[model samples]
Target: MVKIGVLALQGAVREHVRSVEASGAEAVVVKRKEQLDEIDGLILPGGESTTMRRLIDKYDFFDALKNFGTQGKPIFGTCAGLILLASDIVGQESAHLQLMDMKVERNAFGRQVDSFEAALEVKGIAEDFEAVFIRAPYVVEVGEDVEVLAVVNNNIVAAKQGQYLCSAFHPELTDDHRMTAYFVEMVEAAKKELAS
Candidate 1:
């Protein structure tokens, strides 16, 4: 079974764990740099981006994550997780990994009360899936290599960068497992290519 690790530093860890398991992959909470090497892929769940950055710096994981990405291990980020993976952000910037090449507007959709559910047409998933957005950010632009999978209100909300897939909405917050399952497939494919 593929072992997928979710960064437990903060955010929706439990929800992500459940989604990964539901997708038929082994789920592990990655709290330390050492645990990172044991997983096929890593996930950064939705939470406060600034706070998550602080926790990442406090644990000195900022560099570890960048280095891991270089190793070709797929990394998926959702919500605040998406903010961390982004290359540029319009708002606060105390700390960001600058991974994905795009600018995002944090909480661009009003406040938490502005949160809503809507059917999103996502690639690799049949039928429209209801995406849950809570204090979500919006992708203003995407890089050349980035593939936009879903959009809402003309704002980029979901994208895939190479092996990494980041979404502005929280797929874990719902019962849908298609997204996680897609990531699992990516992990398996990457492992296969690496082994060859």
Candidate 2:
């Protein structure tokens, strides 16, 4: 089975693991950067971006994570994860990982009290995807190669760029496994391509 690692440095780790298994793939809680070598793909779960970044650096995962993506391994970033993958973050001096070619704004959706769920029409994925957003960040702009997957209120909420995928909402928070399954498919395809 395809093994998908959920970065356990921060939030929604258990939820993502459950979602990944529900999607028919083996899920691994990746606490150490060395575990990256054991998984076919990685999921950076929703969390406080700054804190997660600190943990990532403290554990010396910053480089390994970037190398994993650069090697063509599929990566799925949710919420803060999306922020980490972005090439640029508004008002930030620099970005983390910088794997995806996009610009994101932190907490573009307002505070925690303003969190809400929306029915999204994720392109090429689902006609109606129930998305859960908590202080979410949206894509402000994307490179020409980025494929916008879902938009909400004129804000880009989900997108795919090459082997990288991101969503401003937490798919694992809901029972919907389609998004996770789609990522599993991406990992499987990439693994096959690598093997060949």
Candidate 3:
């Protein structure tokens, strides 16, 4: 089976692991660079971006992740994870891998009180997914190859760059598995090519 990892340094690690298993893949917690090497893809769970960055720096896993992405491994980032995947960020100063070609504004929806759920029309998802936004970020701009998948109030909140998918909401916290299923398809495709 293809192995997928959850960046377990912080955030909704268990939820992501369960979601990965529900999607028919092996789920592993990736706290170190060595753990990352064994996985075919990764999921950056929702959490405080600053804290996650601190852990990334402390663990010395930033460059290793950048290297992994450069090699074309897939990554799915949610909420704060979306912030890390974006190539640019606004509002607060934070460390990022500068991967996706998008500009994101941290806490774009206001304070924690602003957190709410909305039925979102996301690309590749057959039905509306209940998007749970908790201090989420939204994309202000996207590069040529980055496809905007979903938007809320005209602000981009979901996007995909090649195999790297990102959402400014916590999909792991919901019961819906469409996004997880889509990601699993990505893993399977990647595994197929590798096997070939």
Candidate 4:
């Protein structure tokens, strides 16, 4: 069975774990760097980017998390998690993980009171997924390797680059498992390649 790790730093940890398990994968809450060695894939859940970044560094998980990406394992990041994966952050001095090749604007949508939901037509999935946005960041630009997955109101909200999958909305908050299933499939494929 494929084991997926959810960074339990400061975000929706349990929500992601439930969603991942619902998608047919074993989910583990990753708090320490040693735990990274046991997972097939990782999920960076929705939360405050600043807090997550601080916890990551405080726990000494900064470099280990980045190295995990280089190993070719699929990493699924949602909302603030998406911000961490971006290579560049507009109007922000520093980026978190900087794993994905894209530029993101933190809180591009608006404040907390402006949070909203929408039905998004994502690539690779036939049906539309309901996206929950909470102070979500929008992707301003993507590198050559990045593939835009879903757009809302002319703003890029979801994208994938290599093993990195990101969304500016929180999919785990809803019951829909399509997006999580898509990522689980990516994890399975990577595991297969490693075995071969």
> Where does candidate 3 have its weakest 10-residue lDDT segment?
86-95
> Which residues of candidate 3, in runs, are more than 4 Å off?
91-95
Candidate 1 whole-model C-alpha lDDT, 0 to 1: 0.89
Question: How many times do residue backbones clash in model 1?
Answer: 0
**Candidate 2's residue-wise lDDT over 136-167, tens digit each?**
99999999999999999999999999999999
Lowest summed lDDT window (length 10), candidate 2: 120-129
Alpha-carbon error at 143 in model 3, in Å? 0.6
CA shift of 173, model 4, Å: 0.6
Residue 159 in candidate 4, Cα distance off native in Å: 0.4
Q: Residue-wise lDDT of candidate 4 within 1-196, one digit each (tens)?
A: 7999999998899999999999999999998999999999999998999898989999999899999998898899999899989999998787788899999999999999999999999999635799999999999999999999999999999999989999999999999989999999999999999889
Kindly report which residue stretches of model 2 are placed more than 4 angstroms away from their true locations once superposed. none
Cα lDDT over the full model 3: 0.88
Off by over 4 Å in 4: none
Report the lDDT tens digits of candidate 3 across residue range 1-196. 8899999988999999888999889999897798878999999899998899889999999999898788778899999999988878876555398889889999999889999999999987745899999999899999999998998999998899987999998888887878887888887887687668
What's the lDDT for all of these models?
A: 0.89, 0.97, 0.88, 0.93
**Is candidate 1 or 3 superior in lDDT?**
1
Q: Pick the candidate with the highest TM-score.
A: 2
TM-scores for candidates 1 onward, in order: 0.96, 0.99, 0.96, 0.98
Best by lDDT: 2
Candidate 1 residue-wise lDDT, 1-196, digit = tens: 8899999998999999999999999999999988988888999999999899899989989899998887888899999999999888885554387778778899989899999998999876636878999999989998898998998989998999888889899999889889888999899888787678
Off by over 4 Å in 1: 92-95
